[model samples]
Target: MKENVQQILAHFHIKQFQHDLIHWFQTEQRDLPWRKDKDPYKIWVSEVMLQQTRVDTVIPYFYHFIEKFPTLDSLAEAEEEEVLKAWEGLGYYSRIRHLHEAVKEVKEKYGGCVPASKEQFSSLKGVGPYTTGAVLSIAYGIPEPAVDGNVMRVLSRIFYITDDIAKGSTRKKFENIVSHIISHDNPSDFNQALMELGALVCTPKNPSCFLCPVQRHCRAFAEGVETELPVKTKGKAPKRVSFRAIVLMNEKGNILIQKRPPRGLLANLWQFPNDEHAPTRNDESFVKEISERYHVVIRSMERIGSFEHVFSHVVWHIEAYKGNALELQMGDETNKWVTIDELKQYAFPVIYQKIWQAYE
Candidate 1:
């Protein structure tokens, strides 16, 4: 609970910063779809999509998502697979899963309303401190800190905080500072203005200090270290795993695909059957394993291509191969054969889409 919040408040011009930041935001803020209304559902969706994603990238996706599931009830009622299909290219599938789960709980528990209280709202699935703060402040006009990476960076510079942002403990320090200084009259614009400042003017590299509304108030800029204030420790490298994806086709010209396990990474999504092996392993065993496990025989093998898919914590090095299903006794319940056009119906991970691009 300890914070340099008092020191931060004592040093910064809160009143002037609030006036300049909010005035700049009201006039210069981008016409984002989420800002059109105070619907908690829409705000919740946009905030979820914005996490670890760029604003431009999220615009179209936001429009499409709201169109598809315009209401919390609609989203709650949709099938999980169909929801995944709408969110296919967004990467972080878990976000949608958690959002979906929480929305359903909201629909049933809160009578289809997103809770304004921090305790009730944060109790829902995947509703973290950042999300809770954002939805509460933006949707309900609560005076709470939505301290994400952007807010942290902005505050780090303006207050000259030298905490390592990568550390979890650093967030509380920033959050406490935000809680005390957040504008009570216009918490909505205040929070969004801070975020907008970070995204547009106070960029990570070569910040537009001259154009920044609160640049004169920035201690880091005054000290000539705007870019150096938010020190962050680098994360561990993504673990690499190799797989030989076997693409089999029947006489009817259907491709073989299987559903991933219902839990863990890429759960419940369809993908090509992989002959899991090390990168140094020979293709002889790979082909042999595919034939044995899938109950299919192949006369010839053609190396389609080599591809890679990077996730947050792992990198999949995939080597794709193709052949006619010479014989078929397909027995796995999760395995199935579908036409190329029909393949578009089931949700496939971006890596499989890359494999398709290379295959075609």
Candidate 2:
């Protein structure tokens, strides 16, 4: 494998390639908020948020998050619920949960400083290789490679790599290649450049190869198979799951919302009461289910409407029902009755937020 890697490396002018890529990045990099400073905490938050989310979508959230939790100590001192609330509408609640847990760990174990070493950062709750490398290199100017999907796409097309990116082994292979070609002097810019190139020019479908800085050295471009080189097997389609979501209102104009369990998808976030089974048209059974689950009885239920939410691996086909409860339940820790104004304070999943907006 070492000999094979060497053979692959022999094909390119590594130093020149790195110089060109870094130069391109310096001139063309986007003016993202996170790029303003090399703070480890800021870099860490941005990297985590960027996972499975787009740059444009993350900008405002990033600004808001930084304003709220300006420092690692501030993030560590924040309550888990508050952190989740700050991360509201950014799907993938687990990221913020893990980030909060990791921040607390850093505060407790590392004296409120984000650890610079690989071993220390890796030990944090959700600090994986990609995040560790990104923060260390970008924040500390350490010579490490942050090989994310964008980097993978850029490298794969350049070298005409045919490995399945969805596989773990392939990722390690890409990481090794990244280490081999990474600019020791400017690892942060070099790594970010590769990602930027992939994002803006060397795109997946319609790569702007003509504008690509490293197009002169791109193997797939020479071979006329740029788009076809990075072979990836498709994952299974998202499973469709249907549910009946109940929006229970009381005479006081308060609505009933429930907190999800501590563990699982959308964990600990607040949402309207929803069940997997379809409720009866009259919603007697639905009211009964809500009553049984939360220990609260509803007088009647009116079918509101239906909405669909799609996650990476699941699609929620939700039928919404609105009704008035006999008594607003507050005894159950997970259940609450709050006015719409008060509801704004709690963190709700985006799907429920949409429902609330439409209902309003």
Candidate 3:
């Protein structure tokens, strides 16, 4: 490890760089609420919530979450529906579900405390390598490296490593390097400083190289190629999809909303009844199909609007229609009519939320 650190420092002149980075971090690290506590539970929650989520966006959610379920037991006790409702509008519902399950496992299996060992904790629900290292080192002062996207970018650029970042071997290489370089005495600070440097100075686009503490030591800076480091293979393009969303409303102003099937895209979420094919000029046929499908009678049909939404893996072209319900029967077990006030009770996926807002 000493040899590795020495080589990195000698190659990139990192001693002064690390020193200055630590100094800047002391005074300039964002005053986030999560930074105030070293508790592994709190840190773990914050880390999970922050994954693929921006810092500013996670702030309020974190505070609200901690306030709601401060202790591991509380989170463990929460119902999945209740938890998902609390996590409404947060795109990745799976994270919250995993988090809830993990807390329950921790409470029942490991007492109330989050496990301290990296290997043990990593095997827990939703506890991946990055998260395990982050919790162990930041909360328990273990000499482990938490290599997230920010850390990866910083390392790749500073060290000028040209490996494909998406590959598993590249990640392991970074992890091994970080394991060797992180200071054992003050593991938390060292780990955080690297992350902070990446977030603040080694940003994805137009990094602030001039303000960086380790600018002189960065290989990308010397070579004028900071933007190009951490190369990754391209993934398949997002799939495109189309759906016809039926906004059925009665004279009473109650709108029909149905819960998605228990699994697959937007699982268990509330949405307007919809189909794949768009209606031609005579949308009456579309309404008739809905009536036949749900065993309901459609008294009238009116076109509201058309809109589209994009998700991580698919794009939705939704054709929305307003119809008057003549009869009510459930073809799908999860269908229901909900008032505007009642709509707030259940969690709708973000895409549906956008359409709901537009309807309002």
Candidate number with greatest lDDT: 1
Give one digit per residue, the lDDT tens place, for model 1 in 85-184. Answer: 9888887778999999999999999999999999999999888999999999999999989999989999999988888999998999988888878999
lDDT of each: 0.88, 0.85, 0.78
> Would you list the rank order by TM-score, best first?
2, 1, 3
Distance from true location, Cα of 8 in model 2, Å: 1.2
Clashes of each: 0, 0, 0
lDDT by residue for model 3 (127-149), tens: 88888888898899998889888
Model 2, span 1-360: residue lDDT tens: 233567778868999999999999999999999999888899999999998799999999999999999999999999887899999988888899999999999999999888888999988887888988888989988888898999889988888788888887787888888889998988889888988998899888989998889999999999999979678899999999877887877878888888888998889999987776444444566667777876667877676778999988999988887777766345467888788888888899888887777676
Candidate 3, number of clashes: 0
Give the TM-scores of the predictions, in the order they appear: 0.95, 0.96, 0.89
Angstrom error of the Cα, residue 135, model 1: value is 0.9
Worst 10 residues of 3 by lDDT: 1-10
Q: Which portions of model 1 miss their true places by more than 4 Å?
A: 1-3, 277-280, 326-333
Q: After superposition, how far is residue 218 of candidate 3 from its true place, in Å?
A: 1.4
